[model samples]
Target chain A: MSSEVAVSKTGTRLRSPRHMLADSATLGPFLTLLVLFVLFSLFIPKFLSWRSVSGIVNAATPIGIVTIGVTLLMICGEFDLSVGSLVALGGYVFAMLLLAGAPPALAALLAVALPALFGLLNGLLLVWTGIPSFIVTLGTRSIYRGIVWLFSGGTLIQMLERPAVLALFNGRLDVLNELLPKGANFRTSLIWFLLAVLVFQYLLTRTTFGNHIFAAGGNAQAAAAQGVNVSRVKVISFAFSGALAGLTGILLFSQFRTVRVTTGAGMELSAIAAAVVGGTALNGGVGSIWGALIGVLLISMLRTGVILMDIPFIPADNFEAVVGATIVGAAVLNTWLGQGRAKR
Target chain B: MGRTQDHSEPLVRMEAIVKRFGTITALDGVDFEVEYQQVHALLGDNGAGKSTLIKILTGVYPPTEGRIYFEGRHVRFSSPRDARALGIETVYQDLALVDTMSITRNFFLGREIVRRLGPIPWLDMRAMNERTRSALRDIGIEIRAPHEKVGSLSGGERQSIAIGRAVHFGAKLLILDEPTSALSVAETRKVLSYIENAKARGLSVIFITHNVRHVHMVADAYTILRHGRKVGTYYRGELSERDIADLITGERER
Candidate 1:
């Protein structure tokens, strides 16, 4: 009779909602982002406009590109903090070369290759020394940033007047007007952004490389036991993340019409916040490009909301503290609630 | 199950298997044999060199001195893949799966089905998922969707999935390292059934555990280990479950 009763209770527990989501802590970030969106929509009036929405997406695109790449590396249980430095390096290298009579396409290509080389360096140093990625990237961050300063002399290389570069970056292709109501023009960057996202999605979902990435991150020893090339996955992931950040550097330079040594300063934190906000775990092995886009959108929303609200307590530039606090707060809340659910 | 050897054929042979971790000898001159088409129970205590011997078999750590024979041919496995290529697979306690990935993806992870396109290649998701679904169903694990993430599966279900992966990959000798150690009674029974299914398929399995109950239920023959040495090898019908337990917990002699 006791055995029968125990069996019934076990079955009940198995069928319960709590038991369903206890699988892994991957969904914590996704749930938190949803809750945050609901909360802000209820409270913030300026958050609902189409202009506001598009603006948030525009802001997210550059960071979305970087976050996607970093999440791929993070999925492999590695980090590349030198990405911010790589961004600065990428922009400066491209801008200087373009000024020295390089073609616009060539300038753009170097921007990607230079940082990819830096990524390769980070990879070789990491494997050879067997140091944690945090320490390795810290050292490389300083090296890359110093090169950015030396190469560009700590001055903004104003590319606003460069007609060739401007055409690619500043050009607008109005394909969205056909889909939406009148006067809705599509920026070329959005197209580029979507294409990149789609390509990464395909690689992650439909290619063998995606499998290798997850295997390497989930358990390197087990992956190696399964005949996976673990080292190559780490190298490629980190290098790819850095290279993607480089693309953003060029994009950022175009948007701001300038490139300086500190062009990518503090971008890593924001990228990470967006990635975490989107549904990526700090421990890695689970993330979505959809979640990341949403995460970046959330951050952009928070920024815009704070600005439009004219929150007088904090001044501009120092507002990053508030933003940082909010993101960390979200992460903490997400982790706590997710753990509680898993326990249940 | 005992020795079902019709011919003088031994599938795997270990001669003087020696392993050391710094000053401590984990395995010392242990000789073990696994015949084809039999379920072998590796009985041992926490420090009875069970893990070391299994590691050597799966090619995680090289034997300090001695040799291994696979199908009567001398084989030196430098990696786990090397061991698997010659037919060896291990299902550890952790399951070693990415919880977020789908069942099909996890099953065909390292050895994915792919279609070549000129110089490029793409993973064939449909074929892989179909195989994974059938593999699970064959073991009495009727998972509703092969697209379901492995983390979503219950403990027993996860074991079923893991076992299915091993069977699909054609591992001749599957080394299960304490499979039912942390499982519920029901889950343990499910795992035992899966082991029987694998045995029915004529796959030689090394069911390593200290649980004599586990061995008594599914194992054909038992190889007992104590203090880095083989105590004895006994046929299943010759000894009782309690006696096998005594052997594992050091309560009796060989």
Candidate 2:
């Protein structure tokens, strides 16, 4: 029904001073991590080692991918409390495949498929029930973990000689000796991780679907009025989050050489933590993949460093308190920044 | 005060639109129309069905008994998407925008620009920014990058972006619900200017509000409702402010 109206001829686009504040929200966490990295390097001499760096990158792989999906969910203003459960479910299925003599390719496919299906179930339940995601995923979480525990009898699935699948999990593409300083150009899951980030970053920033996601999260009513498929966006977001968690579960199975329901038990909390720490607000419509990565690395390092220091580290509950405080701190910092921007 | 009557063909016609909530009727057999390139103001007191009428037209709440016809076609909307797909765009009072995203991102939400080579495409940030700046400037709001987060914008600027988005999309039918009710006088004037600019572009606009005075400034037709029923549809030249004030608070009848 467009009447073919001409575009604005106004010579300039006026931006409010407050914009600077929200724009800088991601910056604070980014810069803080940067500062922490510098400080940690100075204090812990081995912080800059390639092996150490590679280890961090590798550890961050699974959770980082999950965090990217969570970032999207956050932008769409939803959360997946079921990812940890899905991870457990997917991992078990993958391991079971290996144990049952399934080829590496089929096992990998099933690993991604089963959990993605679980995610779909989560999505369908979420949309059909009209229940809040917190409740829906919460329900699905138990269903998934229960199935895994019930079927597996609470034992880990161990496999022998998973050469193809193991290689897929930890493989690297190498030109051998001709590529720059390093011989290998890629790590398998690491490659997937970068693609996840790049594809997601694009989805969040470039496409109409991405915009619909932000719109739905920003204000569902408004988005609907603008012709966005809000319900579809919600379903897709939840499914995507679940699917990523599933992939992470597959990786966990490969890396651990075992599939235990407990493998993904607490990773959801960490992924959520990483998402929040990276500036994907729990309420949604704001976050970055880079920020989630920084957050994941921060978490992994914090946990690892505590072990290395032999500090008889604080209890999990106490650590949760730190995370809770950090979330509040990030919020306060963001609000203050927002207020400052308004002043400008 | 030629604020609420357009002399041309009606761009939008809603006849006997009746909506109910439980047993209570929200909009009772209301009749309304906006002419081609005219600003029709829908005025009513609180709980007088002003919002119900707006919602129905914008597809938030479909009428239980009535028909909406746009450009002579009978239409029924089950959702806001239905309305927008037919070229109906609404700018709400709060000006829903993501403060975390840039102005361009906000403007183009649900409708984005992409620069792809073959199958892989990237968001053309430069073009989006340039286009957003120009779009806002086109609506007489010039200052802000496409990348500037909307949260930091002034209330008026945010309002302008919302309006700009609607105008940029080139909808023949535009609905504005209480756009200026929350703004300062200067901001209100800025909004009015945009409305006038929209009017100049030949867009049929529905301006909904309880504020009668604002109608004097920009509306071409007035549809006054009291208790969910249409009191009258009067041309700007036909009615005085006191006449409608009495009709709305209930002095004049029929």
Candidate 3:
């Protein structure tokens, strides 16, 4: 019996240096982010300054939180295009409740829950009708935005009241501000973003639900055959994505004290871009929340770099073109790395 | 039906089984029995209701008419999960494994070993990995690590893992659908030996295949089905490979 155990060739092949590098999902994105950070620091005079670094993180907070949810859903092999509208819907709900003399805690809960419900609807539609999530979320995206438009009468809803509860969401970090030099502006939203990343990354790596998410996305039929309840997993993933988007809206409104129909316009594409750039596969079943965070940081850094460079031909307003190119390049790099592992 | 007092009854017995798909009668009054600690080969051509019979047994579809007896008691399964709950596990050709996941992860996929921290249940990675390694070792397979991805494994190794997982999870009656249909000669030999290993460990396996050679390798008893009806069931010494082939193709009457 001992002689019958033929040693696998993969045991030797996996020890190779290339395979080691390819095996870690976060390494590629992390390296790219480091390279970009160095390049930006060298070319731009103030790029390495505390103010510039903090600004990039600040800009990444809302989209970064949204991308975490998108990454989870993407790993489960689905998309939520309605997330941008859900963000706006979340902001509207929160602001409306606050104006109606509701407690800030209750308002925040309802805001998050409402968007999560919409996300649940997206999952149910996909599961029941057997439609692709891309299409289902796309249709709901416009419908959700329209609902926001009608609710707010296509106008801005601004609040001047700065309740203590609002500070928990996006208040400036007073201690850090006092310790650091002037212009080093940090906010509570960054803490919220980091917390979201930690919790979700843990969810994807350590939990049973996370295992099922990978299995569900990797092979739905195979997962179902093992009694994994794939539909329920996917629906839960969709709801998570929606809840995150709503949370992003709360972060936005808390900082700016403003809500409008166009609050989260075009955010879905950015969130997807960040997730993809972080090495999340479009096909599902393979992704990392950590990679996605690096992706968000990389894109935000690019936006800042492009603006600071002040190149005449590639102006700040045209930063999206650079981000788009980064997305395609990162996707190609991810595929090449993935193939290297599979080829073994 | 009352439970049989006799301890020597067959592990599974299906009497006068019939299945209909709308206007089509896929199976017609087929009777099959698998004894304890035996490799029972179910040989048939494609569309000979091999799948339908197994599906009925595994609870994929309810039988239109028939009674199933397991452990000498009349039983019916509403879903594949119910069958699994009764220690009846079917390993289809595809193996129902997630390729991108680790061997240990696949080994304990739906039935993961977990420890609770506060209210959250976290995967007990150490326990699962150790158990997977030892379980495969018990089945004469020594894997270097349990964290190796299933995609990186050979076909024989993958089959070994699937069979090992089923056996480790308490599968008393294992139903393997074409366990060697898509393997090289060496890989097929490995899978056949795994089936033997399963039988040696006190498991009753219903090995379904169209290949006579594979049946000759591991089967203790063979049942022949042609055109949704059983030609006959025979002991290993009663029929040669040629006789079994001819019976399958209906060129020779039973």
| Candidate with maximal DockQ | 3
Candidate 3 lDDT tens digits, B137-188: 8988878779877766777788889899999988989999998988999989
DockQ scores of the candidates: 0.35, 0.39, 0.58
Model 1 spans with C-alpha error above 4 angstroms: A1-51, A172-186, A314-318, A336-344, B1-7, B20-24, B115-122
lDDT of 2 at B194: 89
Sorted by DockQ (best first), the order is 3, 2, 1
- Model 3 bad stretches (over 4 Å): A1-14, B1-6
Candidate 3 on A1-344: residue-level lDDT in tens? 13323446666332554455567768888988998899889889888998989899899999999999999999999988999999999999999999999998999999999999999999999999999999999999999999999888999999897988789999998878789988899899999999999899888989889999999988887788778999999999999999999999999999999988999999999999999999898888778999889999999999998898999989999998999999999889878877765665
TM-score of each: 0.89, 0.87, 0.94
Candidate that would win on lDDT: 3
> What are the lDDT scores of the predictions, listed in order?
0.77, 0.75, 0.89
TM-score of chain B of each: 0.92, 0.92, 0.95
CA error at residue B105 for candidate 3, angstroms: 1.4
Root mean square deviation (Cα) for candidate 3? 3.4
What is the lDDT for A11 in model 2?
Answer: 30
Model 1 interface RMSD over true interface Cα atoms: 4.6
Per-residue accuracy of model 2 over B1-254 as CA lDDT, tens digit each: 12344444467889999999999998888888877888888888899999888889878887899889887678888877778877788888774566656788778776777888799777777887888889878768876356666765677788788888888887778888888888888888888898888888767788888777777788888989999899988887888877878788787685
